[model samples]
Target: MLTLTENAAIAVKAVVAGTPDVQAAGIRIRGAEAPTAGFELTLAPQPEPADAVVEADGARVFLDSTAQAALDDQVLDAQMNEDGSVRFALAAQA
Candidate 1:
C-alpha cells in the first residue's frame, strides 16, 4: 500500500480544510496512460467506490485502480513551492 509522509499528510489536510463544505474531502490521484508517465491530482469530496483509500495523520488520499497499483510501494511527499503552493512527489519506499 502507498504511504504518506508527515509533510504530505499535513499538506493534504490543509488543502482539504480549504473546502469548508466538504468535511471528508481528500486528494485523489489518477494515472494517465502510463503510471510512470504522470499523475493527475484533484480534490474530491470523498473516495470513489473503487478507489483505494489511504489515510494518515488525519489526511486522506484516494487512488484509482491504476494509481493504487503504481503507488503500492511508494511514499508520497509534499513540498512547498515559492508561490505558496503544494507540490506532490512520489519516491520509492525504503
Candidate 2:
C-alpha cells in the first residue's frame, strides 16, 4: 500500500482545513490508463466506489485501483519549495 510521510500528512490536512467546502475531503490519486503513464492527485470530497483508502495521522488518501497497484511500495513526501510553498513528491520505498 502507498504511505504518506509525516510532513505529507500534515500538508494534506492543512490543505483540507483551508477549504471549508472540503471538510471531509481526502487526497485522491487518479491512476493512469497505462502502466508507464503518470498519475494525478487532487482533493476529493469523497472516495469513489472502487477507491482504495488509506488513512494515517488524521489524514486520508483515496487511490484508484491502478494507482494502488502502481504505488504499492511508494511513499508520498512533502518538501518546501524555493518560494516557501509545499511540493508533493512520490518516492520508491527503500
Candidate 3:
C-alpha cells in the first residue's frame, strides 16, 4: 500500500503540473540494497530541478514494473520547508 500525505500530494501535483524540463519525478521510499535488509531512501532526483526537490518525478514512477516489489510499503509526500528543499521520508503505509 502506498500512502501519500495530503500536503505531499498537493505539493507534488503542483510541481509536476507546471514544470516542463522535469522529465519526471516522485518520492522514493526504497529498501536497502545488497547486504542490507531494512528500508531507507532518498527522493528521486529530477532532470530539471536539483536543489528544490528531495525527490524528482522522473522515470522512477514508470519503472515501477521493475521496482514495485522494492517499493511496496512506501509513501510519497511533499513538504514545505523554509529551507525550500522538498522533504521525503519513509512511513508506515496504510
Q: Point to the candidate with the largest lDDT.
A: 1
Alpha-carbon lDDT, every model: 0.91, 0.85, 0.47
Candidate 3 similarity to native, TM-score: 0.46
For model 2 the TM-score comes to 0.84
TM-score versus the correct structure, for each prediction: 0.91, 0.84, 0.46
- Top-TM-score candidate index: 1
lDDT by residue for model 1 (1-94), tens: 9999999998998889878655588999998996458999999989999999999988999999999988899999998777879988889999
Supply candidate 3's per-residue lDDT for 83: 71
| Better-scoring candidate (lDDT), 1 or 3 | 1
TM value for model 1? 0.91
Ranking of all candidate structures by their lDDT, best first: 1, 2, 3
For all candidates, what are the clash counts?
0, 0, 9
C-alpha RMSD for every candidate: 1.4, 1.9, 7.5
- Which pairs, if any, clash in model 1? none
